[model samples]
Target: MPAPPSAAASTTNSTATLDDDEDELNDLRVAIAQLISLPQAGSEVKEKGRAALHGTVEDMRAFLDTGYRLAQAQDDRVALAQLHSKPDTSPELKTAVRAILRTSDPEEMRWFLEVGQYEVDQ
Candidate 1:
């Protein structure tokens, strides 16, 4: 077999791994920041983003993987309910909201809240 790695080589490998981990963490931080900055991001999304920023790497990954979508969906539902309750909301918008609710798809609801609602209003 080949000779074992020297102490210097082992240290270099460890340092490289650390650098990679730091880069990943930095990327995750930037992603969370971007999510928090979104105009369409609701309170739940913002709150979760903030939490993930202050949490561990796993927390950030969890937020990006699942938490963000779930929080966005919750916020979307709340927004739809608020819009439905509003007296001045247009009939077309209300109808669109009803149709979105019927679908029960979080992604569809999120899309309606983000873009489809404006299209319907216009």
Candidate 2:
């Protein structure tokens, strides 16, 4: 197996850490207590002071599709994981993701991006 999905992952908090008693977790817990005791990540979203207009869906689509082109070798596991985690984007976004998943060939997906529904505002 792939080393038991080691807690030693590339991205922060991307995987479940094995050491529940680790100093980092304790420190994080304390820090979290302090933070929650304050506001922001602790406070509810409705309590946020100021927020601006969100980015366009097109922009988000482009950002998600960055780096690799269709059929060019991409991490399906990572993509699936991300999609599975986010249960609150949009129906259209989810459709796009599902469409991408439906594509068996990555190269074909790339073509779709190049000359398909992958429309990004300039």
Candidate 3:
């Protein structure tokens, strides 16, 4: 192989690219944080996140039936799918669902990119 390239010639541009990527990532994080801070973002997110879950509403009722709750972001997404398909669920159940929304809540619009729990809408 040729002699090792000089640091200035080969590596000077690498840092600039890395910095661009870092800046983008940081901006995304800030936007996500803002959405999480909003009270309604959680419920709004639950809808799409529920779609990501890909389950019927009955499946949701069954999941929650045991009274045991899912603590992980993926589990909560699955739970939302099940709830979304439920037929004619009462308002009380809605209230209860909202209550449980805490921790399961994902930042809205970003499609829960963080993959963890968030604040619930009361």
Candidate 2's residue-wise lDDT over 1-122, tens digit each?
Answer: 45555455544454335453354445544433343243212123212111111333343233224422221334443343365457764566556656776765666444444444335221
Question: Over all chains combined, what TM-score does candidate 2 have?
Answer: 0.27
Candidate models: Cα lDDT each: 0.91, 0.40, 0.45
- Candidate 2: lDDT of 107? 60
Q: How should the candidates be ordered by lDDT, best one leading?
A: 1, 3, 2
Decide which is better by TM-score, 1 or 2: 1
Once fitted onto the true fold, the runs of candidate 1 whose alpha carbons sit more than 4 angstroms away are 119-122
Give candidate 2 regions above 4 Å deviation: 1-74, 108-122
Model 3 lDDT tens row, 47-83: 4334323544443333333211222344445555555
- Candidate 1, 15-99: lDDT as tens digits: 9999999999999999999998988788999999999999999999999999998888888888898988799999988998998
Q: RMSD in angstroms, all models?
A: 1.8, 19.0, 15.1
TM-score of each: 0.87, 0.27, 0.32
Output the number of the lDDT-best candidate: 1
Candidate 3 C-alpha RMSD relative to the actual structure = 15.1
Model 3 off-target regions past 4 Å?
1-6, 44-122
